[model samples]
Every structure is written in structure tokens, then in C-alpha cells.
Target: MIAQKAGGEATLLPTPAILERLETKRAIEGDRTVSGVVQRARGAAAYLYSAGVADTSSVHVDSGYLTPDDMRSLVEKGAVGDVIGRYITAEGTIADPELDARTLGLGLDELRDAAMSILVIGGEAKHPIAHAIVQHGLCSVLVTDEHTARSLLDAAPDSTTSGEDPS
Candidate 1:
């Protein structure tokens, strides 16, 4: 694994195990059972993530690209953003946005909560999503091609220049 190559041990959280851990709660029957399952699974994932994040000194995330619309649809279930939805899980499976809430992946909040989120992404086609990620402060460190970096800076809102008066 990449962690081994980097001289670190990888902490693997298998999705099946995560779901299995919540299976008992999901055994309850009701009209809202499926929704409840989604909530429980999400909560379980969050708990595991919190434990991992809290114990770690740093985190390295290799995030994938989804158009802002796709990301919103996946995360918000079409309540906002584009109504049409497509999802790509962190494990790289393309799945129905509505049915794949249980897909194993890191949420935006989880990424931001990490002590360090080093985002690695680039490509002309990815510029928009990359820009959105940076604009939203999702990444504390970014590794990308020079062109993409320049584009990010160009699109950024103007701020006071270093060693200059704000007045």
C-alpha cells in the first residue's frame, strides 16, 4: 500500500465492517427504516472518522473530482443545486446519487476537520471543481499543476497585498 511505501502504516476501514457495526440498529422495523439506516450508517462513519482524525497528527487525503453540481446533489439529495445527480464514491464507484449515501467516503466537514488536508488534483477540466474546493476552504494544502495554481490565484477575491496598508 502507499502508506507502506511512505514508511507509515495504513489504517483501513472496510465499508462492510462499518455497515456491519450498524446492522443491529438497522434491524428495527418501520416505514422510515431505510432512512434510519442511512442516518445510522452516516453516524457510524462519522464516529469512526472522528476517532481516526482525533488520534492522528496529520491526514493526507486524495480526493476525487465531481462538478459542484454533482457534489451538491450527492450531499444534499437534490434539495439544492442541480436536480440531476451523479455520484462517484471515494472508492471510485459511480453510483446513483440517491441510493449511494452509504458509500464509503469522507464528507467535506471531515476533510476540513483534519489537521491537514493536502488536496491533490489538477487538469483543465477540473479547474472549476478545484476552484470551488479552494474557495470553500476545504483544503489546507494543495498540490496541483502550475497552470491550475495560477488560475486559482487569478480567480481569487482580492485581498490586501503583503506589506501594504489596508486603509
Candidate 2:
């Protein structure tokens, strides 16, 4: 909400928009200390916290100053994807119950409602995460390299994509 209000769209960046991928809690705080990006994100989180929408102590992110300790917590609960917001699984489940309760961002349902959601990601490590968001219908479109794209399709099971039965 704050990023969008401050001229940031919901489009995914090439890097991991999710915090854990950016930092390991001791890895120099990943992208938080970067020049211009942190300001907007921290500002956003601050506003949300002030508005009682988020808890700053939960703001353990180093990527955009708005991390709610997203990745590790969710990954432990079988989360495959960590989008810009919260943790979601390929089955469209919320991986981390604790983080989910305190986050001040859009829900998966809300993200799906955005006019357009383009996910930009790459790497073998990111395959599972990307798969969850795409499988869950959170992203309207994916913006990844051919290798990762093929990887996602190859990993797919014989099942419906949009809740429609193949039969």
C-alpha cells in the first residue's frame, strides 16, 4: 500500500523481493541498507505500524525495511513461495501462522485482485518459491528466464491450474 502510494507498482523485481532470500539475518541485512529503496519500504512499514496494521518488531526484513521475517518463518511451515508480501504455498496455503497474523500487507486473495501482477525471478533456488506464487494464482504474469520457466512447468503435476477440472 505504501509502496504503491509512493509510485511503486506491484511488479516483481529481478531479485528476490522477499526478505529471507535477500538476507540470512546476519548477512549484512541484504538490501535494506541500499540507497533509495529502503527509504520507501521503511516508510511504508512505519506508516503501517503507526496505523496499527503491523508490528515493527516483526519488521525483521533487510530487503525493503518492510520484512515481517517472512521467509524463514514461512519456509519452516512448508512455504514454497515468498512473494513481496507473505508466505504462500503451491497449494495456496499460508505457511507461517505467526507471521501471517502480524503482516500489514495484502493477502494472497488481495494480490490476485490487482490489475496486473508480474513476477520477476530466477535461479534454481527460486524455482520452488516461484512455483507456489504461480500455482496459487497470486501472480497474473511471470517475468523469468526460459530456464526457470521450463523448470516450473517440468515440476508441475497432472492437475488443474485455475481450479477447473481437466476432464
Candidate 3:
């Protein structure tokens, strides 16, 4: 909803987990027949996000589309979290594009320039992500449950030193 505050409408979508589940179910029921759905949705989203980034006219965060393999690769590469398709590193910088094809939406500049950035995701697993976002000043406001808040605070946070790993 931070986008609304910035005079833009928030376009909410299913989390990457949900999309992954759907894709898995479809795979179970059919196989590659349903995989095209992710591609179609991703292509359309990429187009829309390209415009958003160009115009500096919109903001969005989506997950649940990245497959387990995709997320695992990122995690292995020191990614703490992802938003709007872009990976956030431990130091709060977007992951380097060299790691993989960058996702659409909210480049670091776009995110920093926003009047306000809000993060509503949480979980023990999400602690590092929240920490990176907070330390990096990526989000001005955060909406999370008490348990998640506590966990995030309890988990020692790390400062992002650079956008990419030396490797």
C-alpha cells in the first residue's frame, strides 16, 4: 500500500510460494503443459514492470513465482530476500545481474526514491530479508506480526557492503 501513498495504486499478487504451489500442482496433474503459465505471466509482468521502472510511476513486490531451484540458487549466492522479482543481498543491495537474469520492477534507485517503501512479509526464514531491507533503508514502513518482529530483532543483522559478492 506504500505505492498508494506515493500516488500510485498497489497491485497485489499471490506470493511466490503460492505460485510455486500452483505450478507444482499443475505439474502433478499434467506436467509441462502448466509450466507455460509461469512463462506467460512472467512475460506480461516483465513488460508492465519495464514501463513502471521507466516512468517511475508504479511499485510492486511479488514472490511465489520463483521455483525452489531459483530461490535456492539465490540463497546460495548470498541473497537474503527478493521483492518484485529482484533479489536483495545480505547487505541490502540488489543482487548482481550476473547471477542470473534480473527480474522486472523496482531497481535500487526506484525503490530508494519512493516517498515510502513498505514490507509486509515475515517469518523465521524471512528474518535476513527483513534485516537487509531495514539496514539498507529500502523500506520506510513495515507491517509484520509480533512473532516475526521479535524474531527479526533477535536475529543478528548484517550490513550490506556491496551489491555483489566478490566471486
Candidate 4:
């Protein structure tokens, strides 16, 4: 399932139409449950399942930036579930190679075989993260800006691999 953050304020983001489409397609093709990592999406899933709009499972993890107790509070308030805490080293930043990689890896490992694939989409902000996702073998697909796409293509060994910033 493709899980994307809704736009606007944290509380004002619109329901993701892509998710609805995927859910609908899966339902018409056969019984399938799409999984995602957002609280509102989870609530929507519950509603959709009840209304026969779609079938889905929602998994929520603690935000790595939040304190454990605070994150637990969110879970208690029904903002999230499956409170997996952050795994960090002494540096305070994410010790994992990349943010999305850590999230995807943890999701796949904790959820076991349920996680089939991961999709990362956005602009340049997601480029490095997408690279890490590919390196970690977490996501099979990546959606990015044209500039980032060209950069990736150029970075390939078969390409020229020249005229690029090494750092």
C-alpha cells in the first residue's frame, strides 16, 4: 500500500486518494489488506472496511524525535499503535544509514512477511533517503523529481559518472 502524509496542518491533511484507489483495486481483484503508518489513515481504514470501501491494516510507530513516554502518551490517546521506539547511538541523530531505511526495515522486520513492498515518493528531499532505501533493499520503487532522477541516472557506472559533486 502507498502511504503518504496528507497536506495542510497535521489535523487538516486531506484523505489520501491514492490509498483509496489501491484499496479499492485490491478489494475488487480479491481480498487484500493494505498497510500504512498514519493514525488518520488507520481510522479511515476502519471506516472503509466497515463501509466496504476498502480493506486495510494500519501500523503506527513512535516518532523517533519524541520521548518514549510522550510517544506512549500519543498511543494512549489513540494517535498511534505498535509503539516501536527509535534505535539511536550516542550522537542523538538516527544511527541507521538513512531515516526511511530504518523505518522500512523496522516495519518489515517487526511485521514479518506482511510487508510486501515500500514506495517512496517526493522531490529532492527524498532523493538521499530513496538511495538508502535502495541500498538497504527495502523499497523496489522510487518516485522523485526530474533533477534527482537525472542525477541518479548519471551516477550509474554505465553512465558517464562525471561532472557530479562527490560530496
Task: List per-prediction Cα lDDT, in the order shown.
Answer: 0.42, 0.53, 0.50, 0.33
Q: Least accurate stretch of 10 residues (summed lDDT) in model 1?
A: 51-60
Measured against the true structure, the TM-scores of the candidates, in listed sequence, are 0.47, 0.52, 0.51, 0.32
Q: Write the per-residue lDDT of candidate 1 for residues 1-167, one digit (tens) a residue.
A: 75578565444332231122233323422226445544454453222111111011212111222333444444343121110111323222333433333333345555556566666666665565566556665567788899989999888766666655657
lDDT of 3: 0.50
Residues 48-104 of candidate 4: C-alpha lDDT, one tens digit per residue:
000000002222222123344533443343331221222222222233323223231
- Model 2 CA deviation exceeding 4 Å by range: 1-73, 157-167
lDDT of 3 by residue, 1-167 (tens): 55567565434332222233434444443434344443344343121221111011113222334445555566676776565556667786655464323243235655555665556765556666677766676666777778767876666443344564635
| Residue-level lDDT tens digits of model 2 in 1-167 | 75588665542222332333323322433444442343343333222111001233323344353445534555556766555456566577776755554444345665567666666777766777677777777777677889889998888785786787978
Clash list (residue pairs), candidate 2: none
**TM-score, model 4 to reference:** 0.32
Provide C-alpha RMSD values for all models, in order. Answer: 11.8, 11.6, 12.9, 14.8
Better of 1 and 4 by lDDT: 1
Candidate 2 achieves a global lDDT of: 0.53
Q: Evaluated with lDDT, which candidate comes out highest?
A: 2
Q: Where does candidate 4 clash, by residue pair?
A: none
Give the 10-residue window scoring lowest on summed lDDT in candidate 3.
Answer: 49-58
